[model samples]
Target: MGWHYTPYGLPYIVSGLVALPVAVAIWKRRSMPGALPLSIFMFAMVEWSLGNALEMFRTDLAGKTFWASVEWIGTVIIPVAWLAVAIQFSGRDEWLSRRNVALLLVVPATILVLMWTNDLHGLMRHNVRLDTSGPFSVITKDYGPAFWAYVVYAYTLLFIGSTMMMRSLFGRSRLYSGQAVMFAIGVVVPWVSNALYISGNSPVPRLDITPIAFTVSGLATSIGLLRYRLMDIVPIAWATVAGGMRSGVIVVDSQDRVVDVNPAAARITGWSAALAVGQPVVEMLRPWPAAADACREHEIAANGKGARQSEVVQEVAGGDRSGDRSYEFRFSPLLTARGRVVGRLVVIDDITERKRVRDQLVTQQRALAAMEERERLARDLHDSLGQVLGFLNVQAQAAREQLSRGKTSLADGYLETIVTVAQDAYEEVRENIRTMKGVLPADWRFAPTLERLARRFERSYGIQTDLAIPDEIRDGVLGRAAEVQVLRIIQEAMTNARRHGGARHIQVSFAVAAEGVEVVVKDDGSGFEIKGLGGGNGRVREQDGVRADAGFGLGIMRERAEQVGGRLEVRSAPGMGTQVRVRVPLRESEEKAQGRDAHEDSGR
Candidate 1:
């Protein structure tokens, strides 16, 4: 069981065998994004192969020459491996702009020149010596200057690469950072130990310790790589995602000290992430009096509640002056593997747009209530006033008839004139009431309402209107609100056809699908300049900003349709009649049928 015993080879041999299959599996699976780690693994396998070869050659002449060649050939491999690992780990490969690509190509060439000339000769040995009683059958010079440069170059790449890797891995599942650290130590420690041995530093009695250390580092790294997926998964990397979001996120221990904050958290909270790392979470976030104090106390009191607590919307003052920012502070406990809560996660999302939408909804609701009131008053006057006028006309007619039947000498001129005036006034009032009712129909079913509207237009404006609607739509488009919006939009289009487009005929067609809605309205009438009309998305306003009579109808239809998350489309031709089509989404259950149809279509 001594270091030189064959049993000592057990670990290296086992690790090498195990690593080969795992590396192959990883290569075959190809789940990871970068190709460099696979390259590093290839290098490791080569080194392992050489080590095994050297061991076998210990008692043979040809084996000795092979080992000598193997030992000196690092001139080509080490620098290449270092450069590859550095580029991959730095995450600069993906962003290799022209400028960076030039650097990438050049840096290695410089390193190679230094290696061959022994200028960077500090890292690789120019000579080898034979010795007895050492771990190998031989030993080499300390080669201080050469060794120092070698150590410096290798370690500098490692240290810089690892720091960047850890930063990229942070806040990911603890598995990520932990694995990265493990891999880094696994590689660096052994390499450093070997350097120390080369310098004649006494620790393990012989250079044979390099293999043992290498075996340990390899085992540790292999374990971590398998467990965490290391460079194997295609993702933004937890550290990169957490660092790049616009919201503030904080992780706090039970003691309330801040354990983590991303760059976004720092920018929003006005605290440098590095400086805020160990400060109290509450102090860093510092919500107003009640919220800040409550967070600390409640977090401790709740202990391990699996609930996510949220705050009432609060205005965050002082930042960009776009408007007041309202934040919804969400608090969820961070739990350990065993389900015990270790800490809490705080996420602050800017809900300013949500607040603005809510305010707009309130204003619209008030306007709707006022419109309803006006409609109610208009209806009341129409019904009551029309009946009163009819009764008065009947009475005047009766009086006039009675006076005519009586003697002509008894007829009063003033009475006759009064009767005539009252009859004319009653007729005018009746006509006004009819006009006030406008043109809405009593029935509102889809097909029936459409038929009624078309007939009314034919009779009133002497225009032929044709509506082509299928009996049953494969995709259902008629939610209550959507139905109303569709009807109103049609009504408006018909009005426009008569008043503006001067259409002779109209056709409306609708097609609906599970994913979305489509409506086409085509009209042949006196078409105006379409460009001058502005796109449909623009607000239709009156000359005085009160909304044009035509514009009002369009606005109401658009608003109602948008409320139900549907859309309205209007199409017209200059002299041709207009056709309008309306379509809306079917529910998820219907999507299955639609998908089947789609699949069948694709098959065909």
Candidate 2:
């Protein structure tokens, strides 16, 4: 059992030692997808290298044969471990089921048993002897039937694993290319080395250089682990992430050809990946033409000179057996490392539930806004027309009382007052009806509408109404809602002047300011104290020397101003005329729009 140190066997020893740390490093990252199996593969390489090295260093034939048998342990494990690494690395981990693993181990396990029992049956190897040919002694033997059977099984697995590794070279990401190249070299070098040794074409006679070949394989794997970050950034198979995702992912090349389609995409477009790939994307996505057109247009733009297209997102509606479904397709360009446009990545997200929720919320908001408008109308009627009607009823009662007392002149005066009150009430009713129809004209001609309103006011109330609207602020300046609100505020001001302040002359003017449009309604009427009006709500108490009903109108006008991102101000004294100035911004704020929408939702 003596052993001699052989420089020829030193390379195998160095390979085994070098592989030890690599195997340990991979084992430490065993939590990663392919790390555990890869670590096992490295460990098998270490055993096979070291065991062969020890066999070559042994002097006795029995010692050499014993070490050769020991080498079979790693030899038997390498193929299955390599296949497992390939499967896990390619993201086909589901194929490594317990049943499938046991089945894969069956042949390797049989070969191991036969190898250990080879002395009894000689099915693994025979005619084993130590040959001191060339620089060192090496074990030589004629591989028997069982050994050749294991060769066929091991080669089959290695071939499959090599094919999987090669397929990763053509993946979408450039990051995986380097890792795949390293893996290919690692798998192929050892495979070719073994074939050369088996064919007796080894450079050293009777010397198997397969273990030394593993040194090259180990070096390739080490480079991949260090430089390419092999196990850290795994190259997942298409089925792993893209196929399992709920969103549909479609990859189209620059020529508008469908390069890849995930399972979710297949289900969405009603075309399998096999049928979709290599076909024209426009034709493949004919059912979703909007998505196809988006991809095609982006590709066309990308291919054009000086065209830098951005990502596009569009929502499309498609009907299924259940009902209509909404899908949002996002098109993004796939650029290579050199900044060249290679393809487009289309991601389709099913947004049916989001759309349904949004529509329902919108309907609810509309219903709430209608109800709020009705309530506002009811309040207006109670404040203006109802009071007029009550006064008319009182005057009629007085007229009847005077007639019953035989006071003809007094009754006649009361009758005339009633007629005047009834006429005013009729005008107020018509005005309310017009206001309820909305203040903005069908054509949205702001200036003419304001002029018409001023003229109508002058005719109806016998007041001299002057309008000084700027020629620049004629049309298309304000949004429709802002126009409606502005007109309503002006109308409210004029009505209050005639009904409450007994104004004989009213002037409405508009001025363009740096911020926005400024509207001023000045009236020569008996103005009340500005302090008489309450805060924003304009709810004046009886002690405030302002009619509570008048305060309601002021509050509404202020609210209208605020709705258009504006402010309302009142300036007045006991002897001076009152001035209502409102400044509305030209541009709407997002916060203001959201607040208005929320207010409508809450029916406020």
Candidate 3:
């Protein structure tokens, strides 16, 4: 096998060399969509060009024919590979299944076999001979029906692939449009060269310039790879990811013009994507003034020096015919490799359901607080008013009995006591009503409220009330719920001192302990035995004028203390004064905070 070199074949060698690096570059990114097929396409171009260059250097007919057959190997693969790249790049990868790809290769594979066995059948080429052309010896042949059939098949695939790339020119970003334009040129240049060669219209006879034409195609792809980052950022993947998202996505350029809007964004903004592109972003987002203002603010911040990519999230409310809806808008700046701001990306997420659930939880909490308030009111009425009414009944019967026995002076005394007791009950009823109405103001101070309660107790019961609270205790803060419970406990203690123990004087003092504030209420009165009060039920044997079950107020006071994360203790013995102590933690527990919130709700 002898070979001859000519200057005419150098361009093919250069074309083959130029395509080598492009093929390797694309192969490196083969994991991306369309990359594998595009790399295969470039590899096929390399084989065709180099094989044709070798065919031009071969002097003998057999050597030239062998290289031409080798060139046919790449020739058959190019069209099918190009079609596959188009399908994958256009986001139609589902169509490139194994069975479908195999079907696509059927005609190319058959043509190659027929060309190899054409000596016997004359179906691929007939009357093949070596033509010593202007600058080199090249093989020339008359194509047969089979060769024409392959030509038609190859052209059909090229046309389809080119058409798909052309469609990407409109309604796409400048990056994608530039990539599509380069691909379209790559596909069309080779097609036109092949057509000229087939029609015998080539400038040089018997030399197919189709392989040389591929140099232009390879250069176009290289430009796309470098300038537009075709393999790195595929537009079809962007479309599939952003278009199918439930959240709205909008992209704007540096000038605040709408570069792209996904379908979800179009629905959210009530603007069509086709019409929204190239419009001013401020005008497009006019319906949501807050969102528009956020975009403007982000753009201004992004333009500053050393500005890095950051996301700003804010909740926005919009009203419609049904009701108000909430949405969370997330704004992020789009930056270039040089850290220059290029645009902004906004994502809108609907949060109406979340807001609705939150409001429903608040409503349920208020209802629960109302129920708790009613229960507290019931306990207060039983502890104070019920006991007063019972005393009035007993005193009225006593006065009637004295009058019937002709003890006029004793009856008159009983009447005077009844009048005083009636006035006290009236004041007690008014105080209970004020408590039910949540009379504790928002800025209510613990010491002042306690002092006022002591004064009222002194006036109602004719008992000398002494308060010995420290400066720290007076200045300390307590949650409204805990404060209310503490005051009620003190009131109950005072009442027990007067009624049950027949106390004359009551002393209330506070001391700061290790864990919290400790309150002590002492009375100089006829104290009952502390025995039989172990079970929190407040059951005790009868002592003095108090009934066996008259210790119910003690049980109620213990419950109120526990509700506010506190503890209560009572000490008493016969002929000794009664002392009630309560310890309340300084820091509110989770349970206590919830109770405070409930108390506020009831107040509202």
The lDDT for every candidate, in the order shown, is 0.54, 0.76, 0.76
lDDT of 1 by residue, 238-284 (tens): 32336567877776655566656767677667777667765877786
1-61 in candidate 3: lDDT tens per residue? Answer: 7988887788889989988998898899776556788789889989999999998888999
Top candidate on TM-score is 3
What digit string (tens of lDDT, one per residue) describes model 2 on residues 311-335?
7787888734214778888877664
Model number with the top lDDT: 3
Those runs of model 2 whose alpha carbons end farther than 4 Å from true positions after fitting are 171-177, 230-395, 406-604
User: Which runs of model 3 end up more than 4 angstroms from their true locations?
Assistant: 117-122, 171-177, 229-258, 262-315, 318-604
Please give the lDDT score for candidate 3.
Answer: 0.76
lDDT: the better of candidates 1 and 3: 3
State which candidate, 1 or 2, has the greater lDDT: 2
Per-residue error (Å), model 3, residue 552: 24
